[model samples]
Each structure stands twice: as C-alpha cells, then as structure tokens.
Target: MHSAIWTAVSLFLIVEGLGPMLLPKVWKRGIITLISSPEKLLRRFGGAFVVAGLVIFYMVNK
Candidate 1:
C-alpha cells in the first residue's frame, strides 16, 4: 500500500516539475496570466505549500 502511494506521488511531482521545464513559454504565460497581480509573499507561500505537500506525501508513503 505504502509503496503504491509513494510511486503515485513521485510520478505526480516528476510530471509537474518536468511539464513546466519542458514548456517554459506556455508555463510562464500561464503563470503570468494567473497571477498577474501576485505579491512576492504569495508566491513564496505557494512554493512552500508545494514543497510541504510533497514532503508530507513522501513521508507518509515512505
């Protein structure tokens, strides 16, 4: 059970990270449009959320 969950989470993060890197223009455009009025604090917080979520998911599954 745990192995399956970890595999899924790992795959998800790999895909998420790779998608933007592979298509920088599309990703950047989307980000700009989505967070046009974004604040630095919010951006940092969003990143923290992603990292924390990934960490939690990995720890639990591991």
Candidate 2:
C-alpha cells in the first residue's frame, strides 16, 4: 500500500511535468490564460479536479 501510493505520486509527477517539458510555450500560454481567468472560475475548475480525483481514488480502492 505504501509503494502503491508512492507509485501513483511518481506517475502524477511525471504527468504533471510533461506539459512544460513537451510544450513550454503552450504551457506558458495556458498559465497566462489561467491568470487572466476569473478566480471563481479557477476555483471551480480546481474543485472539479479534486472531486474527480476523489471519485477515482474511491473507485480504485473499492
């Protein structure tokens, strides 16, 4: 279980790094867009991700 958690985290790190590593310009543009977006919208978007992650985690564990 410990290693499973670490493995998931490691994969997440790799995936999170891919945006900048593969297309830095696009990533920068995305960041700029996000910066310009409304705080409420960003919070909602982040909240959605958190909910989705929780659902996935629950399904995986079950």
Instruction: Give the runs in model 1 whose Cα sits over 4 Å from its true position.
Output: 36-62
- Candidate 2 backbone collisions, by pair: none
Relative to the unseen true structure, what is the C-alpha lDDT of residue 8 in candidate 2, on a scale of 0 to 100? 96
The digit string of per-residue lDDT tens for model 1 on 3-53 reads 988988999899889859899899888778767766886788889999998
Per-prediction tally of clashes: 0, 0
Model 2: how far is 55 from its true place, Å? 0.7
Predicted structure 1, TM vs. truth: 0.47
lDDT at 4, model 2: 96
Please give each candidate's TM-score: 0.47, 0.88
Per-residue alpha-carbon lDDT of candidate 2 for residues 22-46, written as tens digits (9 for 90 to 100): 9999999999999999999999999
Query: Distance from true position, residue 36, model 2, in Å?
Result: 1.3
Give the range where candidate 1 is weakest over 10 consecutive residues by summed lDDT: 33-42
Q: Please name the candidate that would achieve the greatest lDDT relative to the true structure.
A: 2
